[model samples]
Target: MSSAQWNAGQAHGEAQAKTEEWVKSAQNTANKACDKMADSRESAQHGKEQSAGFIQQGAIDGVKNTLGINEKK
Candidate 1:
C-alpha cells in the first residue's frame, strides 16, 4: 500500500532469506564434520580389531612354543 510499508516488508523478507541461508550452510558443514568423525571412528575400530587378532595369534604361538610343538611356518 504505502511506499514505506512496502519497503519495510521487503527488508523483512530479505532478512529472513539471509537467515535461512546461513542456517542451511551451517547444517551442511556440521553434517560433513559428523561424517568425517564417523569414518575416523570406524577406521580406529578396524585397527583395534586387527591388533586384537594379532595379540591372540601371538598368544597361541607362545603356547605352542612352550609345549615344544614344531611350527610349520
Candidate 2:
C-alpha cells in the first residue's frame, strides 16, 4: 500500500476511536445526571409526605382543643 493510503487509514481509525470514546463519556455523564435527578425527585416527594403528615396531626390537635378534649400531657 502507498504511504499516503496507510496514513489515511490510520487517521480514520484514530478518529473513530476518539468518537466512540466521546460517546461513552457522554452517556456516562447523562446517566449520572439522570440518577441524581431521580434521587432529588424522590427526596422531594418524601419531604412533601412528611409535611402533609405534620399538617394532618396539627389539624387533629386543633379540633380536639376546640372541642375541649385536650388530653393531659
Candidate 3:
C-alpha cells in the first residue's frame, strides 16, 4: 500500500479506539450512578422503618401513661 493510504488507515483505527474507550468510560459512570441511587433508596427505606418503630413505641408508652401504669411510686 501507499504511505498515504497506510496513514489514513492508522488514523481511522485510532479514532475507532478512542470512540470505544469513551463508550466504556460513560458506561462505567452510568453504572456507578445507578448503584448510588439504589443505595440511597435502600437507606431511605430503612430510615422509614426505624421511624415507624419509634412512633409505635411512643404510642404504647403514651397509652400506658394515660392508664396511670407509669405513675411514680
Indicate which candidate wins on lDDT: 2
User: TM-score ranking from best to worst?
Assistant: 2, 1, 3
Expressed as tens digits, the lDDT of each residue in 1-73 for candidate 2 is 9999999999999999999999999999999999999999999999999999999999999999999897945
Better of 2 and 3 by TM-score: 2
lDDT for 12 (candidate 3)? 100
Regions of candidate 1 where Cα sits further than 4 Å from its true position: none
Runs in model 3 deviating more than 4 A are 71-73
- TM-score of every candidate: 0.87, 0.95, 0.86
Name the better of 2 and 3 by lDDT. 2
Ranking by lDDT: 2, 1, 3
lDDT of 3 by residue, 1-73 (tens): 9999999999999999999999999999999999999999999999999999999988988998899896545
- The C-alpha RMSD of each candidate to the native structure, in angstroms, is 1.5, 0.9, 1.8
lDDT, candidate 2, residue 18?
100
Candidate 2 lDDT: 0.97
Q: What is the C-alpha lDDT of each candidate?
A: 0.96, 0.97, 0.96
The Cα error of candidate 1 at residue 18, in Å, is: 0.5
Model 1 lDDT tens row, 1-73: 9999999999999999999999999999999999999999999999999999999999998999889894856
Model 2 regions more than 4 Å off: none
lDDT of model 3, residue 64: 85
